[model samples]
Target: MAASVQGGRIGNLPAEANAFVGRRLELAEIAGLLGAERLVTLTGPGGVGKSRLALRAAHAARAGFPGGAWLVELSELRDPDLLTNTVAQATRLTEQTLRPLLQAVCEHLSGAPVLLVLDTCEHVLDECARIAQELLASVPELRILATSRQPLGVPGEHLLTVAPLPLGERDDAVALFTARAAAAVPSFALTDANRAHVAAVCARLDGIPLALELAAVRLRGFSLHRLLEGLDSRFDLLVSPARPRLARHQTLRTAIGWSHELCTPLERLLWARLSVFTGGWDVEAAEFVCHGGPLDAEEILALLASLTEKSIVTRDDEGAAVRYRMLDTVRSFGAEWLTGLGEAEAVRSRHRDYFRWIARQGEAEWLGPGQRMWAERLTAEHANLRLAIEECMTAREPETALELTGTLWFFWFACGFAEEGRTYLERALRRARAGGGPEHTLAVWAHRLVTVVADDLEAAESVSAAYVWLAEERRLPVPALPLTGASLAVRGESARSAVLYGSVRQAPAGDGGAEFFQLLTLAVQAYLLAGQAAFERCAAVAERLRAECAKRGELWMGAWGDFFVSLAGIGLGHPDEAVLPAREALAAKWRVHDRIGAAAVTDLLVVAQASRGEEELAARLLGISRRLWHAAGLPQLGRPDLSVFHREYERRLRAALGDACFTEAVRKGRELGPDAALALALGDTADAPGP
Candidate 1:
């Protein structure tokens, strides 16, 4: 159910499977399972090359199911709860599923000719089977190729019992091992001297692919006689002549055990501790989280790097960060090793604290607009952030957990992650309320207020009590508490909003909340709503800042100020005065590349241009504005409270245009309000009817 930062693992279908070396008969056998039967279960003992065979056939036949072929690997999954998510991911379904995910799977797959390759289903047989049967029944065009130890038993499932690679003369297994061993260690060839022994070993092992490969690894070091001396005891011996019927089937566990026994002690320790990380870790993270008695951070990093070379960890192709993760088989082996070492919990806690410190550093960088880029860096480590929150709370380190979520507010909002933001904020607030440190409450109130104001007035007021609590506390960061005033204003409590802003103890005029952005927003609201006189006084201070923006060519923010100024001008009925400011808003929008704001400002410009008798341009610009707004996904009217703006447009259009054309324009603008739409469509109302 959780999202992973670990680079995803994709198992390759054997190369010969693609070339389909000597398996034309086998391919036809599997192909028959797909026709008339929606489910084909591939049952085989471990290392019998089941996955390679099934996946290859599915890949070859992918053209028939134009919908696509998807592989859902069940090996890495530790929790059965994750079954649906894994399937969802494999099918490339991005939307959330509330009903059982299996039902969602059917709905998504229904009538879509798709072949799903369900690999390694033995561990989660029941969940996999339930999904397979539902898919087979509901999806007319869906088929499955499942690899498991046992049959799914779902109706219409044709069992294709996969055998190991053929072992006698002209067999694929002996040839593959000989080729791979020669490639892995060049000087030591699989000549006639070792050929006889290798073939005998393959027969004894029932030609299991995994066992053959492991045995091939020893050809460089051990003579055939020496290897045979240790053969029966080693998993590769596979010489169980008396018990050919064992269900153990000379399995994955034996093959993995032989690999684990070869690792040095330090390497083994590193492997075990690395499992404490929920996702793969970067070198620095591995150093700190897995540090131990003899292994310092440097040694841990080196060990991780070394493990990658040995295939214990897979290195990622993405270069933003060099990271490593264990393969499913190796991870299982490492987990067992970790339990024996008895250090899982302590390693997990260290991992949590490492991320907490990262959050603290991130908080300092989030203070200014530079925060935007810093938030991006933090984003790359999101899984670590989530794991830190989860582990810290579970460990009762709520203080650190609260800060972790609190500091990431910028990333939560700016990155189109609002729903995710709400989730973490809720978690942080609860922890802060329970036993988190003092900053928690401030953060909780701030996060809640942002969510409320952005979503709805009902939400803003829902947490009014929290705002009142912060006001009483009056901390320096209580600027967040004062935001309740803005929320209240949105809810029609202008007077209360005024009083709260006025009540804030101001520093000297030039102090300007000493570089806090919240103070700037608060000061802007308080100054403007405090009425015309207060706005004029504050405009002088704003003028000084506007000069700095002009100097930097930061037309965007300058236009933002002009927007508020134009609104003030319109309220005062000084159309002539509003003209330059409204035009400036348009310029600012284009200057900063704010398309949404650009379209909005064009509407305002239409009203201004009409007031100034620019009818030809106003009419054409209105058409452009309408087109832009439609394209921007906001085709409706502007914010609900802009009636005065509409009236301004109507006044200009009526005065400058004739009654006949004005009447037709009025007919068209009628849907949007004859007043605003007329100003938007045909400006210049010198002889127009009164609003």
Candidate 2:
């Protein structure tokens, strides 16, 4: 079952960078179709400008859809199974529940009028159809606009066949070519001398937008007459029998082939090597992975520049670095050539090596002054990291997969990708189970420790036995003693605290920053679990860790430290003393983007506030806590015993305030969004005004 949710809102859509030429008629027809039908698919071969036309129409129709129009680009996504997740991510659905994601999506769009543009659905046609069908059936106000090389053929799908640009005397085809040429050569124009030659080039290319654009780029280096002459040779070599297939597909292939024919050997080799990359890449990455054989490391940048100039690869100048990406059509063409050359595996191996190095560097640098920077960097490289895992799996190199997964544990933990991380970890474990040896043992323990934090007790325990046995057999020092201690403490198992964390009070200085902070936080929790007798000692330890975290600028860890210290104060019957620290920790957790942590700590803060007789504020916080818990896909988190105070505190608040008053206060609190709640928790009440 899905929980109640706000109406859907428009997510992100890529900005149009260049002038969109001549789709007025098609755009009007697409807009009309979308208004009259539930599912409108713009079908045509790739490079026939289906994507550009659809995006323009969607952007223009945004105001008509009250909930807003959203675009989900499928070209970079390879796994069809992730179609739902990809869409959910694009829509920014953060509900991490046991309910099916589809159900969550339906619940989100239940009463909203939203237009979803599924771009480049050809590769995942069936999956896209299924999703559109399901969403439309469940959400009466939801509409879908999909673009593909062929029809989705789902019932009630209105197909708008996207044809090539009209090859008339002054149609879109010639206009698009002239515009691109002017950009490439500022002095170039449609003069009487070269107009017929340009028209002939466009005609031979079947009036395909992609082909004409490619031809125009060549004008920067070749005359119009030279381009037309060279195009004939390439088209002759690309000739195929007249079959019932896409003319633009053939035209696009020939254009891509002609571009390849025009490239220098080094540029051609670099293009083929660049195909291994799923997303864009920097010159450093291209140099490292694509350099070898005839392509010298020194020549990569120059060749990359040449390819960018020719428009085979586009460059994204992101302040610090200029990254490059080939169009999906171009990348696919290059990938086919790479495979035919029997160098696909070799290229992929290089990619995996480069990414492995990056993962290790990130893991190493994640603990100090660069913690936040490293987090952002890893998040940006996440797609490429996934590709590395795929490469390892494809090569049947489970050990490499294990190494990469183990190294990325900190990233997953800090960034809240627990679910997706678990998927990769399990896949790696299965492949490594046969003869993984020591690395396998380490991976198992790492996986177990992460599971405990993700609130998966069953999976945690299932691996706990294996991890313990392996540690004993291998005589490997157990590095996650604090995690076990925290689990026991939250479970009210004070008796086991001595065995779990008693000897690890001052974990060796050699421990990485991630391990040290986790150990410190969990140790404090264990101390608190010793009941009132250990309150003073727990508070002291937590305060020390909090001070250490402050010194190091670790906001997230400091939040947990404050949480432990606050609990200690509450355990000592000083609930008022707990309020400040708990509120501080709640604010810090939200700042760190730890939603689950924020939710868990908010309950404690609410209790502390109520105990101090701040009935209204306490009731409001309780409502916010409810929303946080619901957003995290749980009624509660951590050990069930840890919820005792949460239940008791709410009970007390309800008694102090009448039921109706409590309900009204909660309604107000629920209005505090994630950002506003954090602001209120941080004592920034000006922006989070009460309803």
Candidate 3:
């Protein structure tokens, strides 16, 4: 549910999707607890609105945390081992170092005033508690707000029990029902004629928000009187004889079950199958994974619409695209039914297979006009991809898992997820080796390339010799040759790197997508040229690469091309010519969530400004670049060639401005958020210091 704010920092919290009808008192109390307590847990039964309240509270408290407020949604996450990595990603803490992921996250957060919201932690209670305890112990100014059905049992945890809405005349539950009822049927209202019936229905459902919402959807089909009568009969039939005291959760479950029973047979089938998805999914995904046998593929859209009308599925139409999701409680109910039908594994297989196709398609089309679209699409489906990978691993389909993970190397490497890619690749490689499957040579090389980008040279080298031998034995062209050249450049082997890059560029276009390889080759070649002090040649090659990217309508590689052009211009001592390309690269990189690329360009901007004798502005830009590099988990991308330029520029700026003035300018820049820094770089000058 995280949304990107253009020109600003990425917001980890979900935007309010709809009107919040009630809970003024609970909100006030939570605001107070957050003021005094470091850890506040909102405990309640399922569908009692804990997540909604927590999100609202986090948004209210966001301004207090200069480090930013982040929400780590744990509901879709199945593996307890991934908790730390998931949290780190939510905080935008990339890991390109050899340190443990937790240590990296703690280090990134140390001394920062951050509010971390761990939503839906019941499934990973023990792990969540462990992480929370460690983070609290390490970060002095950090606060945590967690939502779970029960307490996490961590020290210094304050529990706030969230109860069902008070059923008073104008209380939350009735107001919630009325609001949802109006949405269901615009002409519907709480009239004098049906006031008693509305109150009867709310009382029947025990004021649970989810139940009320579901019941409100019935308004489109049934009269208020008939709906009340239906709920009365349904509730009585659903009560368990063993537990005469109908618990609150049981009441909620009965409501969901009643809604399920009312769906058409096809709608019910699709509902159960759709449970295979972890996060929200789109129409294409649902059709692919949920259709078969009794449910025809062509009927999926209509069935999905029916399910949405019945409140079994919720639609998100806020953006340009429409997506759908079920409440966690509703999804759980469908999962139980899915397991009962013995179709869980089959549906999950289809889910995995569908995402596998997505990975393959993304890889196939990565070098074309659809590059930006693929990047955005894959990012949207990231949770589903992770779910599919988990399913493959759970089924012991390591070969398939490796193929899927390997095909997504571009996503992991170019889209700011190299660290996570390394994790999945390592796991798949281990499992594939243990399974005694065919030596997946392509996947092995892909893993090595990702490791190199992640700054794990030792791991990258481990597979180097074997991959080369295998590729030659099988007569397979090394598709990763350009990246191999990049690896050499990172190690300061400019001469050798240039030779490799030249061979890749000169090779005839083969079946290995040579056009893509050539693009990469040119990028690295330009870098090598710049490092070797051939500024004019570097600029010429980079301009050609940028023009190619423009013709192909590609943004990711085009941004890199712009970066190199700017680098060459700065190196050639034409600082004025460097500024536009630097800004262009930063904007494009930010569009694709390429933090490392943006950081690199920001660093280049510093040098360009310094060479133009704008010493104070250069110092400020330097500070901004430092923060960006830290967030990216790499200083100068851990590349010695780039680091050398960074050091030289900083030294020159410091000498020109002297220590005190330079330090003050950098301090001001470091305090600015991503939005401000970007504005300053783009010549807004509003936040610039006076001379």
- Which candidate leads the pack in lDDT? 3
- Candidate order by TM-score, highest to lowest? 3, 2, 1
Q: What is the per-residue lDDT of model 1 for residues 1-691, given as tens digits with 9 covering 90 to 100?
A: 0111111211222233123333557789888778767888888777677777777787677767655667776665544645665676456342222235566566655544777889989888888888787777788888889999898778777888877778874577678667656655677656666777777766645667666666666655676666555554674355477854324454555655665566678888888887766446688888888887977877876677666655567676464577677654557667777888788778878888888777666545443333434444565565566667777666555666566666565445333233345566676667557643455754565466436432255555554555445444444333434445556655565666654444334322221122223334444463345343554544443454355445434344455566656645655556677767766666555433344455556676666556566664454455445434433333322234644544555566656666556445544332232123324333344533333
Q: Model 2 TM-score?
A: 0.81
Quote the RMSD, in angstroms, for model 1. Answer: 12.0
User: Which of candidates 2 and 3 reaches a greater TM-score?
Assistant: 3
Question: Could you tell me every candidate's TM-score relative to the true structure?
Answer: 0.58, 0.81, 0.91
Q: Give me the runs in candidate 1 sitting further than 4 Å from their true place.
A: 1-163, 186-193, 201-206, 214-230, 233-251, 358-457, 460-691
lDDT at position 444, candidate 3: 70
Greater lDDT among 1 and 3 belongs to 3
Worst 10 residues of 1 by lDDT: 1-10
For all candidates in order, the CA lDDT equals: 0.58, 0.73, 0.80
Instruction: Give the Cα error of residue 591 in candidate 3, in Å.
Output: 3.0
lDDT of 2 by residue, 78-134 (tens): 767777766765664543445576786776555557888999998898898899899
Which of 1 and 2 is the better model by lDDT?
Answer: 2
By lDDT rank, best first, the candidates go 3, 2, 1
